[model samples]
Target: MTEGLPMAVPAQGLPPRVRIHEVGARDGLQNEKAVVPTEVKAEFIHRLAHAGLTTIEATSFVRPEWVPQLADAERLFPMLADLGGAPDIELPVLVPNGRGLDRAIALGARRIAVFGSATESFAKANLNRTVDESLAMFEPVVARARDDRMWVRGYLSMCFGDPWEGPVPIHQVVRVAKALRDMGCDELSLGDTIGVATPGHVQTLLAELNEEGVPTDVLAVHFHDTYGQALANTLAALQHGVTTVDASAGGLGGCPYAKSATGNLATEDLVWMLDGLGIETGVDLGRLVATSGWLAERLGRPSPSRTVRALSHKE
Candidate 1:
């Protein structure tokens, strides 16, 4: 265990304990061209829980035709009723609209997330509606979830850049983010959907959001490694007092609508960095590495996580 560990050197001006929101089971596998069996998805999530990931996203309640890989959301989610008896673990799922929300609620999903885009192009491409129209659609979904006293997370994609629209203005992102926050979202996960965000851009966005009355305490960051800036952007967000981060196991998924976007920030890699900084993530680095390696084997490809590759020694 020590051989693969990093020397703990606590950093200043960073959150003491960062909560990693694991998105592999939902975001990662949703883009798989080959359908991953429902049993494999359940076992994969179980493995993630055993590796000490407390907030593993279980699955999405989107239309089966839209995301065929996750078509078994009905069957796959029920299998995770017991997360190896891990107490206080969160299993959030994505809900696109009221229908999605209804299905999730019927299945007893307590923590749900709504995916939105800052730009009109992505909103239309992903949701087939204008930005305002999509927000209108999500309004009821968020309200219903909140009315049920369930935790709601708003995922604002294209916060940094959009492939179709080019660089998304910080103000544009702030507007959409404020709408989501005002709509009873308990937390908001800022997404660099096209993976073009830098550290400075991340800090500025956080600052702008703060200036717009969106407190730092209710914020999370989600980045991609397209330009190799996800870790840097994450560090910037951490420095800005963000404690929640969205990462995928094995760096699995990208935006299906954005061809230029890449895989998410790998959870194992993020844990390695957090461990080095002495930031408590409650994740066992050795176990996380092994989990990614295991998933990679099942996915029929090597993991994109640098830490997993370096530690597995068989890549």
Candidate 2:
């Protein structure tokens, strides 16, 4: 399909609203070669809140030795803790295991994210464990978060395919997702880790999950734009009743393990599509674009978002 192709969006009368989890501040900038200042990260998140993003993945509480970019997770949270940008906004941090979860909780994090891979090799490369082992590691973390009354979101990576082990099995993805949900995760995000998913692949997976009686309400979709199919795959998810979508503003993230993977779907483009569908994201498209452009300039590169480029040219 061509860029910005208009399609038949579901009627506005649909019962549920799609919730977008904006991850530009953390995931997008983490892959950047240059270091983004903590203050700038805070401002970026503040602007996103102003644009009506209620759920934002704020930062990662991982070791500096691995991802030095988000080493300021502790410092960043406290700085924005009192900003009061949005009344019920959710700021989640990526917490791999006990150590990361501890740091997140120490910083007063109310929400923590745990991600596991569908493919064993990708799991090993990304988290240094097998798929089962990775899920097992989260057992304690999820329990602790539940005890503290904190929100926990689980991410199943390589749901569609893996760079190391291509064409991930649908059963594997479903298994990991079910495991996370069983462990008391509030939501499970199925990721197209290498951006190899097509609308058909997405529909098939959704159907399989539906057949298994998975709770659609607790499911989300995370797509990358590697083959220019992120939005298409998102539309497929919407058709399957998935209302929670994850995107990075300005198209700012990439998979370090998946060499050909592009950034996450652009929030600008996703908002544009949802707006045409009369979906209520409560996000102001113009302000979101402006903030994305500002960061793109700061990073000294053009944005990967088709909507951003088109809108910028129009201006």
Candidate 3:
């Protein structure tokens, strides 16, 4: 739906236009050691929108004690209300529970995301609740958000592997994913939180979801680059008909709850592949690369994205 962007006609299986859900502002900065200033975070979102990102996750409404980095969610959303000169973008904020949802709604957030885990250990560790309890908490949040005419996204983490529990079964992943979908989530993002998923794992999980009557159109893939297979796993998902892919600009985040998790798949890296394959994403690779570089300076390190490094060198 981005202006001037070509649509991928589902040629061999891949969607013509892949929707890149930019999670840099929320997911990317949440794991940083030094809290990025609120103004810098707002500017980062604006720049990403200017670079043609139609859906930019602005911030999370989680408790400040839980994620101190994104504590300014209320302040951040107001700054994004007027995107300066960028395209009209959907800014989604993460809400951990009914309380978080209340805060997001108070800020006039039209879109929000709720996170759940497939494995019990992670559910307990990250959320301090069992998987069922976590889903129970999200049920009301999702229902209330829908009542408010807001979009709700559900994130299922550790779909392939869990640090506390190794090698999660596909059926378990499907069970959790289905629960989220049944709860009326507009979309469900399957996350490889530990980044241990390979292409084969991706294909198998997607296939099982499809077999279970969960449409790929309602699913998104969020991968971490820890094992260096994020992009490869993403390509496999695309071949399986997934059109939404989540990435962080500059590869700026890791899972605090998942000890071994690394930064997410970089937006610039994904855009480079989509551009080369002639898959329309509406992102300007050059501008995305620059945006990553700009954020990297604030993070006090160079971007880990291979594409960002390669493009920066060329420039």
lDDT of 2 by residue, 105-172 (tens): 88788888998888899889888898899988999999999999998999988999887677888988
lDDT (10s digit) by residue, model 1, range 1-315 = 368998989988998999999999999999888999999999899888888889999999999999999889999888998862456789999999998998998888899999999999999999999999999999999998999999999999999998887999999999999999999999999999989999999999999999999999999999999999999999999999999999999899998999998899999889999999999988998888888888788889999999899988943
Residue ranges of candidate 1 with Cα displaced over 4 Å:
84-86
Top model by TM-score, which number? Answer: 1
Q: How accurate is candidate 1 locally (lDDT)?
A: 0.92
User: Candidate 2, after superposition: displacement of residue 157 in Å?
Assistant: 0.4
Of candidates 3 and 2, the better by lDDT: 3
TM-score for candidate 2, residues paired by index:
0.94
Q: For model 1, state the Cα shift of residue 11 in Å.
A: 1.6
Candidate 3 lands at a TM-score of: 0.95
TM-score per candidate, chains pooled = 0.98, 0.94, 0.95
Candidate 1 least-lDDT 10 residues: 80-89
- Arranged by lDDT with the best first, the candidates are 1, 3, 2
* Candidate 1: Cα lDDT at 77: 80
Per residue, candidate 3 scores C-alpha lDDT tens digits across 1-315 of 242223433346677889999998889899999899999998898889888999998899989999999888877888887862244678888999999998988878888999999999999999999999999999999999999999999999999999988999999999999999999999999999999999998999999999998998999999999989999999999999899999999898999898799999999889877876778888987788889999898888999998889878865
Which stretch of 10 consecutive residues in model 2 shows the poorest summed lDDT? 1-10
Which stretches of candidate 3 lie above 4 Å from their native place?
1-11, 84-87
Best-performing candidate as measured by lDDT: 1
